[model samples]
Target: VQDNLEGALTEADIEPLNMPEMDRDELVEGESFKFTLLCQVKPDIELKGLDALTVNRELVEVGDTEINAEIEGLREQNAELEPVEDRGSETGDIVTFDFVGTLDGEEEPFDGGSGTEHPLELGSGQFIEGFEDQLIGVKEGDERVVDVTFPEDYQAEHLAAKLAHFACTVKSVRCKALADVDDEFAVDLGHDDLSALRASVYDRLFEAATKEKDGDVREQLLKGLMEANEIEIPAALIEMAQKQLQNQMGMHLAMNGMPRDQIAQAMESETEGVLERAKEMAHRDLLLDAAAVEGDISVSDDELEERIGEIAVDMNQPKAKVRASLQENDRIHSVRGEMLHEKTLRWLEEQASSVSGDSTSASAEGNPTADDASDSNVEVADEES
Candidate 1:
């Protein structure tokens, strides 16, 4: 069988040829024709010594100082916005005020600039340039006018390159963050206490650091493997990718109630860009899969579940919803393919040579167990229950 397969593969051109011997009788059921397919394998690149593929490992050392800094960041993350008492508007202070603007000192061309108690953060660049700058040092019950110019390339065609003056009134000011990052803060975050918050923060930071470092190693290995391998990818794959992009984009626009003509016009321009990207991505996939198959690397179901769960967490969506969407869209298959690529890259990294920095090496003390790549391919539940 191996010899026959090899012989069949050798006869193929740059593109893969169908293998009639591998055809399944099931494919002949109903009105469909039956034929076996032998996907022409792209030229495989030989990966050498597990140690010869030069790579850099950030040899991260996670000590108490780093942990503390991470914890402090968490505290800032949990910081609260509170109304200020007896505070005036200053740079960086969020202000609620009423204002009107005029084009050439006249209100006729500047409608909609008038509002009561509008919220603006000083120095936030939320308003016209220099508008916020004028708000600095203004207290409640104060009023001032500021001169500014709209940029030549402003989005609003009518106002582009127009000079305008804002007639301003300061109503109230809210000060900087006053949230207490103590036990109360933890409770606010729905945790038991500050210690629990710290523990959670630590776990999150450790996971983030590990992921970043591992991803770096994997990317470097893939870059090397891609450079080493020669592969032939079908032009049809790029066309398919472009069509898929158009369909997805169209679906998104339709969901938002965009018009047909608008979508068609947009697709005409975007299709070219998408095609180029798809070609590059297809080439990368071909090489990665070939390298992975040679190395016997693959992803397990458990890893997919974990990754899906992580995506859900990041998107603030329910795991069940995400799982359903992935399954319905055939995205689960795509996810598996992505996971396979990641696994192959990691395997290459393991066999490759590496260097480390002092900061990375210093943080090597007592980090938790690495997310084991071997434990992948097993089914992982979205919830413990």
Candidate 2:
């Protein structure tokens, strides 16, 4: 309908207000028919007095303390685990075991409550609260009946708040041996030496801090603009925005170990937050589009070629090949849109009084730190990845 209406009515953009029902029963067979479409154009926004808006873009400080912490994290990641055969299992040890669980007083083991030779880090909270504590003193080949009560909000409907016992045996206990932070450690991680590694980490950290500050500035600009010019969001967009956000939050919870069966209930509990976020998304999109028009932000052929040339360099492919691939995948417009969006945001950032960002316009030629894969940038790599 958007394309057809745009062609018929000569309108550039059209947003449908509602999905109207059509009457087809009265049309005769082989007879010519005509239909009219009624679409509500989404509001075109005007960004006025943006130059007077004051949004603080505090520059994040990158200190030696932060650098040291990041380096320490790398050291921890490179640590090796060594078996401790002489002692019984203790906190911080990785223990391997087998176990079967039954309801506190039941005669038989319960379903989905047994494991053999599973390795679990003691005190990691990977299991029920009391389960790991019981393994703390158990030696290899030792057996103990461990008791624990499931949490009230446990995902399993039948097992929530229930007590269970596991007859277990320990196979081994191991402790981590942290690497020494030295030139050798840096060399092992493919860096020339400790100094070189620190320099690289520093550069990376500074870049990250800059990007974070830039994002904060953009957010404040949009928030101030939206507050100044409020519009009621249509129902269709509200439903769409709410569902996408709800699913995203639910997926995050699931990835962090929440069971799927309870995600629906958890999402239901977050109805208000989801609605507000949905409204914010819709509002930001509207304002950005309006700002794009108001500022006349566009991606000229030369600017697009410049961005694609950079993309080709990043992808290690020739510019011609990369452009061909993008065109083949129907992603040329998406790339253009991303560039346009960035240009629009850069325009808004220019209006701010205090911002920690590059003075160069987004389309300007330079080693732009913008690998900004717009919402569309996500799709270009789908088939290839």
Candidate 3:
């Protein structure tokens, strides 16, 4: 039924609310047949999508401070840990310890409050505030009681704002022996010299800044599109969209090693704003399609292939294999649709104006993009449900 609906109405974004009113058995080949479907469709409205949008683009300025920071990070990465024998432990020293955290007056440690052979850097804030402070002067093989209070809004509700005592055994202490920075340092990092490394770092940072600016523009344009257009979506469509969202989330979590039962339990416990998110996703897709039509944006075959080629490169796969996978999953059209959506955004970015102050473009109501949004007749077999 979905395939047929998409085949007949490519950009209609219609969701059928009921079975079609026509009997499939009664239809004859090569003859005109009409069926009625109670469809709740996307409304066509003028979008302020590609207009005098005001966005901000920060100047990509890379100073010596930033370059030196990057170089320091590289130095830290190349540094080795040297065992500390003279001093106990300092703010920047790495301490290996075993700890069992117990709430005040409790005998046994609370769940998830104990660890053995934990390596932590003092002042790194890996542990609670006072916990690290108390570990500051601890030497190897030392035993001490560290006291700290969890934050009021701690993630574990049971432990929030509770004063806990950690029985700690200091195992070892180490400090970073930072690598020397010189002409040889640049060669070690695959650069000709320190100057070349600085230049490369600046170029990388500038490119990242450019992408971030483009992202901001796209976000602002989408905001303008949503604000300038008001489309009434039906409840059935929202329900369908919510299911798709849940499935997508489930797939993502499963891919990340989350147990299916746990995922279901988590989702069940946190469904408050899922409907709103689904509605927003649906609304965004509809508005993007309308913007594409307004911009006359079309994705050519070669363009789609080239985009896939880029994806192939990024994923380290053959272009043909990627194309085949997308085809097998019937996501090729979705890729094209995304391309159209991106093209529309790029066009809007081109038309946007950058200013120092925060400004938003306004749009006026105009003619609908298609025929008046009405309940179109559609036909489906009862068994199809």
Best candidate, TM-score-wise? Answer: 3
Candidate ranking (TM-score, best to worst): 3, 2, 1
Residue 6, candidate 2: Cα error in Å is 6.1
Enumerate residue pairs that collide in model 2. Answer: none
Query: Model 2, residue 78: what's the lDDT?
Result: 76
lDDT tens string, model 2, 84-197? 877777787788989999998798988789999999989989999988998887777888999999999876767899999999987777777766666677799998766666
**Candidate 1 Cα errors over 4 Å, as ranges:** 1-52, 61-87, 98-117, 125-129, 141-147, 150-169, 177-199, 230-233, 239-279, 298-328, 357-385
- Of candidates 3 and 1, the better by lDDT: 3
Each candidate's lDDT (Cα)? 0.67, 0.75, 0.73
Candidate 1, residues 242-353: lDDT per residue as tens digits? 6777788889877877567766766676777878778777767777777687788877888989999998999999999999999998899888898888777766765676
Candidate 3 lDDT at 209 equals 56
Cα RMSD, each candidate: 11.4, 10.1, 16.1
Clashes of each: 16, 0, 3
> Where is the poorest 10-residue window by lDDT in model 3?
376-385
Off by over 4 Å in 3: 1-35, 48-50, 234-278, 356-385
Q: How many angstroms is residue 325 displaced in model 2 relative to the true structure, after the best TM-score fit?
A: 9.8
The candidate scoring highest on lDDT is: 2
